[model samples]
Target chain A: MIRIQGLRKFFGRQPVLRGVDLDVATGEIMIVIGRSGGGKSVLLKHMLGLLRPDAGAVVVDGTDITKLRGAALEAVRRRYGVVFQGGALFDSMSVFDNVAFPLREKTALGAGDIAQRVEEKLAQVGLVDMGHKNPAEISGGMRKRVAIARALVTEPEIVFFDEPTTGLDPILVNTIHHLIQDLHRTFRFTAVMVSHEIPEIFEIADRVAMLHEGVIIETGDARGIQNSTNPIVQQFIHGAVEGAHHVA
Target chain B: MTDWSAGRETWPLPARWVEALGEGTLYLVESIGRFGRFLGQAVALVFIPPLKFRRLAGRVYFVGFKSLTIVILTGAFTGMALGLQVFLTLQRVGSEAFVGPAVGIALVRELGPVLTAVFVTGLAGSALTAELGIMRITEQIDAFMVMALNPMRYLVVPAILAGIITFPMLTAIFDVAGIYGGYLVAVMLLGTSPGTYFGQMQAFADMTDVMVGFWKSLCFGGLVPWVCTYKGFHCGHGAEGVSRATTEAVVLSCVLILIFNYFLGSVLP
Candidate 1:
């Protein structure tokens, strides 16, 4: 389980996250939804130990990751797989090498094993024959798939996705969502994804958390969140412009 | 003139100048502090375990071997120009024999290392900044960090150590090419006796002169990449940021090289 307690963050005196508290149970997909610039990505980063909170404890399975440093911190990070917004594929590397990077760096696997594992991950992501191409040669959606393959190549215990479907076309977005759901069902990795795809994301998320005004105002199952009475939640969910959120 | 006083009346000119000066000073100090911290981290990480020799070797090839032709050409041209000019000036005084010594000493003591450093800064340093800047904007650096890899170790240490290893070697090549070019001009073109030209250079240009060039190259090697990579690592948002960082890296590396060359020339024997 992942527990965030009293998490607060300030970027240059402007509060981005204010006393955010949340929890993610084991093997569940928790989708964090918010307006653009509401710090959803920042929250994901905090959980990954990429950014330390001003005041909070990110306890991962009883260990407070916020206080860990050096190798201790690295050990925690090694268990996590993150798919960044832009795929963040190494430009200098081919798709195959990009997917193979984590395994080559972290494990003592031999060349044959590494190749086999990389090929398996690529095939799982439906990019088996495209491994030799550079990331720049691939489409944006394909790049995201490559990123996902790289992330899961290490068989991490938890995976984080930041704006996974932000820039893709509608069809591609649905395809990506379905792919993510399929992978989650197969791997059963505790998944935390920040996205704004609305009704589509609701199809895959077990729980949806609404982040507003630097805090999680509401969190519940997708159906419960959709039927919530809170004006801010309603405004965000229904894409209403005139509401408490707009007034504030 | 009627409205100039009103606009200028917000503050005295001297005060405005002082404020600008203060801001510039603060920026400079902050940059120096950041550069020093990065250097310390890079140096410390260089000795750590899991040294990536493949990356280091690639950087060495890129920074040193790839720069050979340009360094050689620059050294040859500069030496030829110096030899010609010195021979002409010494001809008036019936001391043309000293042309070889003048050219050799200047090349060995100063121009060889300093020019090589400037060229490499323009070539490799700018490339490093642009490459890493793109990575920064594209989030590759953050990806490395997220993967439990230290960017300082994996990206920076190899590039820096490569610079340190390559600078002196390139400077030596520059010096040798420069001396040969000087010999070619003084003996073959200017009709100076080969014996006197070589004898005068041998008499005056000692190991200390070459050592000075080596030391300067070593410092320049470390400094250029240090500034370039730091700018790249901290580059800002997008394409504009990458371009700005690359420009800053090149300008700062060149400025630092010239400044340090002056100091080293003054201090070294």
Candidate 2:
């Protein structure tokens, strides 16, 4: 489980995350929904140890990741995988080489072993035969799939995806949602996703957490979302600006 | 914790001496460590396979190609000026025949490689650092890091390897073009016999002098790009951060190249 305690963050003088706290259980898919500049990404970065809290701690499993330094932090990072907003595939490397990169760099695996593992992961992402393709030559959905494959190649216990479906078409978005659900079910990997596509997220997420005004005001099972009494949750879920979440 | 007390001089002579000595020693040790690691990494990668033929050849073309005309022009002008200045000084002492060898050796041994290295350091060196720095700021370096890769081992080692392996060739090119430029001036403009010029150049300019400069340029090539990229890659704040990193990379590359040149020249046989 990942637990955040009294996490506070700021940019110069303005607070982005104001003493927020939450928990993500092992093997659960949690979707964090919020408006633009609503600190959803900040929360994810903190969890990933890319950003440190000004006042709080992030504990992954039993270790306080915020306090992890050097090798300890790297050890923490190895257990989880991160897919950036823009796929972030190394353009210089082919798709198979990209996925094999981490294995070759980090582990003692031979080239043959690395190649086999990469192929298996690519197959898992349904990117079978496209292993040698360059990222630019592939479609947007395929790049994301490659990114997901690269993320999962190490067989991370937890995968964090930021805006996984942001720029894809609805069909591609639905396809990625299905893939996420399939991966969640097949591997039972803990997944934390930051995205704004509400209904799609509802379809895949085991639970949805709504962050409003620098706080996680609501978190519950997908079925319980429609009946939320919190105005922030209701408005954010339905895309209604009249009740709460000022459009400005 | 940068210490200001160490910079002061009002203390007792022994205390002041100790403080200055300590600071200087630390500086020397740190610089040595940095350069030592640079050499270590370069030496190790010199024999590695998957030699990145396309990328290495591409970088060589860029670093060596785009700077070719500029290096030749700079080299030629400096050569002619050195020849003229040497002529003036030698005429006063009746050792004017030595002019050919002196300027030839000077241009070939030190000036050619060093000047070309500096020019390329400013151009290609800064470009490498800024490109990597931009990647760092955009989280591309983080992307590499998250993949359990070492940016130094993967990205840096290749470029440094390329620079060291290619600088000597570029230096040789620079030396030849520079001497040829001096020949054009010495024979055509100054009326010196081509025979005398060639004779003096052959007899006095030894391999040691020329090779020292070549080695220096090779070292300069590796040092400039490595430090520039290191500074830029470590820049972490934002857009302003990347911009600062780019500028810092360029400035540091030039400064370190010149400074190391001075020290290496002083110590080398």
Candidate 3:
């Protein structure tokens, strides 16, 4: 389980997160939804221990990760797989090398084993033949898939997705969502995803948390969120222009 | 109009100016501190275990071997020009035989290392900055961090070590090429006797002069890539940020090299 309490962050004079509290139970898909630039990504980064909170704690499996540093922090990070919004594949490396990088750096696997594992991951992502191509040569959706393959190659216990379907076309977004669903079903990793795909994302999410003004205003199952009475929640879910959220 | 003194603030402009100056100074100091910290980290990582020979070899090839032609051209042209000027200036005193010594000493003590560093800064330093800047803006550096890889170890140490190892070698090439160019001008074109030219150069240029040049080159090697890589690693986001960082890296490296050259010349025995 991942637990966050009173998380806060500030960028210069601007406060991005203000006492945010959240929890992700084991073996469940928790989708964090918010408006653009509403600190969803920052929240995700805090969970990954990429950014330390100013006043809070992120406890992963009963250990406070914010206090962890160096190898300890790295050890916690190894349990996580993150798919960035832009894929973030190393352009200097071929897709094969990009996927093989984590294994080569972190593990003592032999060359043959690494190659076999890379092949398997590539095949799982439906890019078995495209391994030789550079990341720049592939389309964006394919790059995201490659990123996913690289993330999963380590067999992480938890996976984080940052706007996995933000820039893709509708069909590609659906495809990626389906891919995530299938991967979750197969791997059963505790998934924490930040997205803005709305109703489509709701289809795959076990729980949806609404982040507003640097805090989670509401968190519940899809049906509960859809039927929520809170004006901010109703305004967001129905995409209405008139609500308490408009005052901000 | 009646009470302008009471309405207006007493020290608004001066206060604002002072505030701006303070902010700028703080920013500069913070940047210097960050660079120093990163340098320490890179140096520490260099001596640690898991040295990456393959990456180091590749950087040497790129930073040294590929940079040879430009260094040679710059050194040769500068030497030829200096030879012609020295010969003409000394011709007035009927002591044109001293042209070889003048050219040789200048090349060995100063021009060889300084010119090589300038050329490399423009050529390879800019490339390093741009490459790393792009990597940063594209999130590859963060990806390295997320993968539990120390970019300071994997990316920076090899490049810095390669620079340190290659600069002296490159300066030597530059010096030799420059001396030959001077020889060509003094002996073949200016009608000076080859024995006089060679003998004077051999007599005037000693080990101290050559070693000083090599030392300067070594310092330049360490500093140029250090500044460039630091800028690249800490560059702001997006295309404009990368471009600005590349420019800053080149300008800063060149400036630092020239400044260090002056100080080293004054201090080195």
- TM-scores across all candidates? 0.92, 0.79, 0.95
Regions more than 4 Å wrong, model 3: A241-243, B1-21
DockQ order of candidates, top first: 1, 3, 2
RMSD of each: 5.1, 7.1, 4.1
Task: List candidate 2 segments past 4 Å from native.
Answer: A108-113, B1-98, B105-110, B161-169, B188-190, B198-219, B235-244, B259-269
B1-269: candidate 1 lDDT, tens digit per residue: 02222454588889778867987999999988988899998998877788889999999999999999999999888888888989999999999999988999999889988899999988998999999999998889989988999988878888998999999999999988888888888889989999998899999989999889889999998988898899999998899999999999998888888899999999999
Give the Cα-based TM-score of candidate 3 against the true structure.
0.95
Chain B TM-scores of the candidates: 0.90, 0.78, 0.94
* lDDT for predicted candidate 3 compared with the true structure: 0.90
Per-prediction DockQ: 0.41, 0.21, 0.39
Which TM-score does chain B of candidate 3 obtain?
A: 0.94
Better of 1 and 2 by lDDT: 1
Q: Residue-wise lDDT of candidate 3 within A125-177, one digit each (tens)?
A: 88978989999999999999999999999999999999988889999999999
Task: State how far residue A80 of model 2 sits from its true place (Å).
Answer: 2.0
Q: Could you tell which candidate, 1 or 3, scores higher by lDDT?
A: 1
lDDT of 3 by residue, B1-269 (tens): 12223433565998768866887999999988999999999998888889889889988998999999998888888888888999999999999999988998899889988889889988988899888988887778878878878888878888899899999999999988887888889889999999999899889888999889989999999998899899999898899998999999989998898899999999987
State chain A's TM-score for model 2. Answer: 0.97
Q: What residue pairs clash in candidate 2, if any at all?
A: none
